[model samples]
Target chain A: MAVDEVKLLGFWGSPFALRVEWALRLKGIEYEYVEEDLSNKSLMLLQYNPWYKKVPVLVHNGKPIVESLVIIEYIDETWKNHPLLPEDPFERATSRFWAKFVDDKFVPLIIKMSSSTREQKDKVAEEAREILKTLESCLNLNKPFYGGKIIGFMDIAVAWIGIWAPMLEKIIDVKLLNEEYMPLLNTWFSDVLEVLVIKECVPPLDELLAHYKDYYDRFMATKA
Target chain B: MAVDEVKLLGFWGSPFALRVEWALRLKGIEYEYVEEDLSNKSLMLLQYNPWYKKVPVLVHNGKPIVESLVIIEYIDETWKNHPLLPEDPFERATSRFWAKFVDDKFVPLIIKMSSSTREQKDKVAEEAREILKTLESCLNLNKPFYGGKIIGFMDIAVAWIGIWAPMLEKIIDVKLLNEEYMPLLNTWFSDVLEVLVIKECVPPLDELLAHYKDYYDRFMATKA
Candidate 1:
């Protein structure tokens, strides 16, 4: 196991950081987790990710790899158990495409929803509705996860949506991803949360809310 | 041959579009190139890619794949000859990471460098120099390409730099990426242009400069 010593530098409340943690756990890969204070990053974090200056940098045998999804792919390939991606090239492409779509489309919109004032939340809801509908189409009611029955790459890529979106909706007082607008995606939110692996990784909601509230206060103070 | 029919819907002026063209030619895959007018999009283009409505949509056996790099990866996997990616997992991950860094960091900085007015161009040059320096560090003086000896995914991903950056320097009158600042990167640029597969795919300099001039005029008019 000495040859397999993996180290992950992460932050507690960040969704991107959580992704690496979940991937490591899913693959049964043992990694030493170093919690980073993003306000003042560690020397190792800086050395690992000089460009992004962000969390979720995976260090394996003194080599540090940045980018969360890239880290997941590396982890999946490095460890042969519980495959995250598909064997077929097209299927793998599809998973990567949607995972990218989720990052590009939904992540920013969710941020916009969370960071807006209560008055602006209502106006942002329309754009949020359209994004959710597009995401909704990617899922299948017959299949439990995005990559079919097993927890595959796309499922792990968006596992944060289920845990985080509900809190954002509650905080902003806007209904962006509820069942009426996006039935299948809404169902996915519920289903992915119930998966034992995902459930364990998501920190408690109250704790998350407290963290986000502090963020919201900081954002509001800046606006004022 | 019938089942393998691949069609690329693209705009000649776009570097992103050129990437797919180069990959297809390299792999010896036959594909029909449909020139798209971005201002007045075709119905098929709209139908195939409703969200981005962008070029370089690769249609293989009827399904349309969007996103330039994603399409290139799909093509490489599907065709398999003259492989764009390495078979090793770590090497593959490194290729993906740098490809993404090019897109996220270098591409936008290049755009900023290209689009700025003469007065602002001087200020932007400092930033451009930093980006080029970081990119330079990735190369090896001993190797022709990023992966060495052969043309690869990183070479294709960044081949635009060789073709476009020189024209941009001439147009903007800014010398951000010269041999002094980046000897290895400057050499990489020269080496990439010499490859026959790349030579055939890149549009002529005069045509590209004219296209960029028109873009520059449009950009100025909007700012005015």
Candidate 2:
């Protein structure tokens, strides 16, 4: 017995939840996926993630782990099959650096989408551009994936947002990750999507956009 | 020869930079600390962290690790002495989770400090309260530190801002972490400060306040 009882509590419309699902699939690990309704969260999910009380909680042998990036790393460490991070410490540190970078920058971009004024949106746009530029420069364009041959933890951590950016641009009527403007990011996006696991794990663009729209509306309505 | 030539490039007033300093001191690792002027960052520092070009870049045995939290973890992993994270996977994940939680919440608080409008300040105040409540609830008051029996990675990671919350309250004229409001957080502040290494590493409160005031003024002036 491999202590193989694994389960995930997630929402289909959530990109954060998808990161964990994709990592589990990529590792060829079998587990149960319990779709969480955000409107009516399960008591188990709430109990497991009492701090944030949010989705994508992974329970392994009855122990719970929250936060998508944290869960991904946990999975990597627990099951050594199909290594997600590089063996080299320097490489691993570099990848984790970008993961934090992406996580930190996501906040302001979300605020921009919920901003009530044009000035605020413009300011956020500039902030978002700087973050995108940082990501662009850090990326190794010559590599087929973020990890060169295969997707790694950094790739999985950011893989969801890469899809969301273009869809968001479409909905907002303003481009964020334009191929003409960011040739490297554009190429990397295509390369990331080439992976069967990632492609399958991604929710449809239309559905993601709809979710973002609903979230934005709810956020703004609360403000009003 | 242990290949132990370690040098840290950092700015004097950055909390992020202080994280590495505190970790090194706690681990009893001797290293050179090179304070870089943020306005005129050293070429080596720039080259070492080209993407972010930010402070708290640690070079160990000639290899550079950027990002404060990332560098902290790298130092912990490489040293394998005076361990900052717990050995158990679940506990380690929990420590990392709180660290990430702290990192995530500071964004809005920083933004509020930099904003011009009272409305913006109010919005951030609400956000800050939510984060504080989470912290005050998640943390065990009886434990002297976040990691019981010792000041660990999560404590040092957030210690800079944790100490500054009172100073931040002084500036904004609001008491978010006062004993009257949050007895546990207030007590934890003194608890963390009781550590000799952490006590010595903290910059003077007056200097920190002065730096933030200068920054806040300039930021608002630019917006005007």
Candidate 3:
């Protein structure tokens, strides 16, 4: 049976959740959004995601799909308009490879940098810069975004960087990317953030900073 | 231009390499396999996969696609035969979620157990059993393989568990999955091993054991 209704379970400030929101909006699919507090996860969130209990679970026709990337792929395949991924098989695979890179290297580094003290944050500065440098190499000075003129799967997958990095830099006092460090990537992030869809998903900067500040403090305290 | 030729650079015992091999053979696609000696990677491999500089680089026509899962997806889409993933987008997403689980939890736990001291090996036994138990629950008292009746993507993704787990058990002296702990999963592993395509990709057990034993020794030495 074709699914009739669509719904999403998410937290407002979560980059993972934002990916789904942006994909759905770009596809122009209308759906209800349920915000979950990570501290006190609701029954629906727990029921939808029994294993990970994480947000960004999409419920289509009452069936729940988990994991942000998996959810993003689901949205792309289900909605034909505004195709997030490329049509070519090899191109699709290349985009997925970069998506995996975002998950494996980029997101974890952001989390680690966010949760570290000033000294500890300094320790990962070069490693973080190297990741951006790799991204710059992909840009090739002519391509505007990861998708070569379009906001692509990898671009949306990385959209969090534009929104979250500024907050992280503010709290950690570590400059991650700039014209000096990664010229192309710095411009790419700027380009991504300027998009209407991308800008709409980003929580207000002041609210985000206040939330991450407390989150970082709690995270580091537990680690200590 | 359409991709005219396919080539693979691989090392014999790597599960990652075996994934590409099984996917190609299952699709009944003809390709040249270049065996790599890990001690000295070929210039082609270095050029094809300069990022990771690792084996299991699939050169379709001339372009290189790295990463095991991404390469498998590319092969499935490009060939259009014996589809590795399900047709339904949600089902495809579900299989990928488990594939991520295998990479994130299953492989790491196996590596940790393989290189652990006797005491540490004993400590991870219960944890390892728990992971298998969760997999067993996914079976829900039915389903021969992760892809239902077929030896599909997840089955290929996890073929290593069937082959390598037994070898790890013998060397580490820790039973990961068996009739007692995860009966359905143990049987599924056995059945997957019996697949001709899967069996052909696996290195001989004695050779694998010897290779892994040395690998474990070197891994522990570095940690010590």
Candidate 4:
């Protein structure tokens, strides 16, 4: 049998890339991580993911798999131990649905919040709060994680909320995940952050804040 | 063991709904189809999918699974026969990546073309054509389907381009899928339409045309 060679092409500050890193760590898979410069992308990064030309591409052996959620699923399926997703088909579907919701609905709101002007920030934060409420309703307060006691797919998918949400709140001067309104989600946010795998993979807070601050400054400059 | 009870709540004009219908048909699964009125949604639809309140909700044994792609995956996993996804892990990821591309990138462009103004129509069509070229490059001219020889996940996910692209071109008065520019994709479109299950489930052309025409008129009126 051939040795399994796994390589991940990622950008340091990307939440999407961090999801892959967390999944790999949770599964205990040893792999190489190549950080790509988004400003001037590496040739291999472009070649591996020509379609999106984006990071979080997992190259196993010689073949490359793009898309973070897809790569996580790939890793889960390839390695049976420490399953990121549930075994039941229905539970798996639910996991996938929530993951999609995070990427499609929730993540975009955060990005919008990041780029919004002073006038637009309040409305964006309000809209984000509404989404957070919906997310809060779905959580099982009894369970420590979304996958019921284990840190699984949903935990990894929503890891951004744990790591980035607080930073975003500080950056935009808005409170989106108040415990009074979203108790379950607020608890889940804190619980997720404490997970050793997640804690280790999170980018340094000051560095991440600096990165987003720079991003915000650039956006404001463009608007001005 | 109790017999499987599958129910799909869908809207006829929605390509998202149509994908689910095609998947169930291809799997040879017995399912009850409930048509949703988007104007006044059913209580059951709202209760089942409170977050999105959209169609293509698959209720299996009373458990509702929203999101067409997620539902299709659930169906594929539950039923053993006529696999929609590839068996190999890498191949499954590839199928998923393309399915997502169809929804995320290609479908949105088509929807934009539908709602665009006369001035915006040509530019949207041009953009749609560029996407078609990328899709075309991925097809194997020798293979009949994106899954190769069989209508699988990718085919069902992209069924809209086969069924709706022609209508969209007529509706918008712009050419998007020229055989000269994208021979393989154009051929795949025809081939996918010819599949017995897909051909049977496609919405009546005259009705579909009227539906979209009314939609276009409403948008234009709003703009005016």
Between 2 and 4, whose DockQ is larger? 4
lDDT of 3 by residue, B1-224 (tens): 76469999999899999989999998988899999988988899899887788979999988899999999999989998798998898889888887887888788888788777789988787777787777777764466777777788988887677787788888789978778857788888889888888777777889989998988778878989
Q: What CA RMSD would candidate 4 show? A: 1.4
How good is the docking of model 2, by CAPRI class?
A: medium
lDDT score for residue A123 of model 3:
76
Clash counts for all predictions? 0, 0, 0, 0
User: What TM-score does structure 4 among the candidates reach?
Assistant: 0.97
Local distance difference test scores for all models: 0.84, 0.80, 0.84, 0.88
Ranking by TM-score: 4, 1, 3, 2
Per-prediction TM-score, chain A only?
0.93, 0.92, 0.92, 0.96
| Candidate 1 interface RMS | 1.3
Name the best candidate (by lDDT).
Answer: 4
Give one digit per residue, the lDDT tens place, for model 3 in A1-224.
Answer: 76469999999888899888888888888899998989899999999888789999999988899989999899898888888898899889988988888788877788777766678888786677777788777764677777767787988888787777777778888887778867778788889888888787778889888988987778778988
Interface RMSD against the true structure, candidate 3: 0.8
Residue-level lDDT of model 1, residues B1-224, one tens digit each, is 45677899999999999998999988888889999988899999999888788898999888889888889889888888888987777788888988898788877777776667777787777776787788778887788788678998988998797787788787778877778768888888888888988887778889999889788778878988
Q: Which DockQ value does candidate 4 get? A: 0.94
Q: Among these predicted structures, which one has the highest DockQ? A: 4
- Against the native complex, each candidate's DockQ, computed on alpha carbons, is 0.71, 0.60, 0.88, 0.94
Q: What is the DockQ of candidate 1?
A: 0.71
- lDDT for residue A42 in candidate 3, whole number 0-100: 96
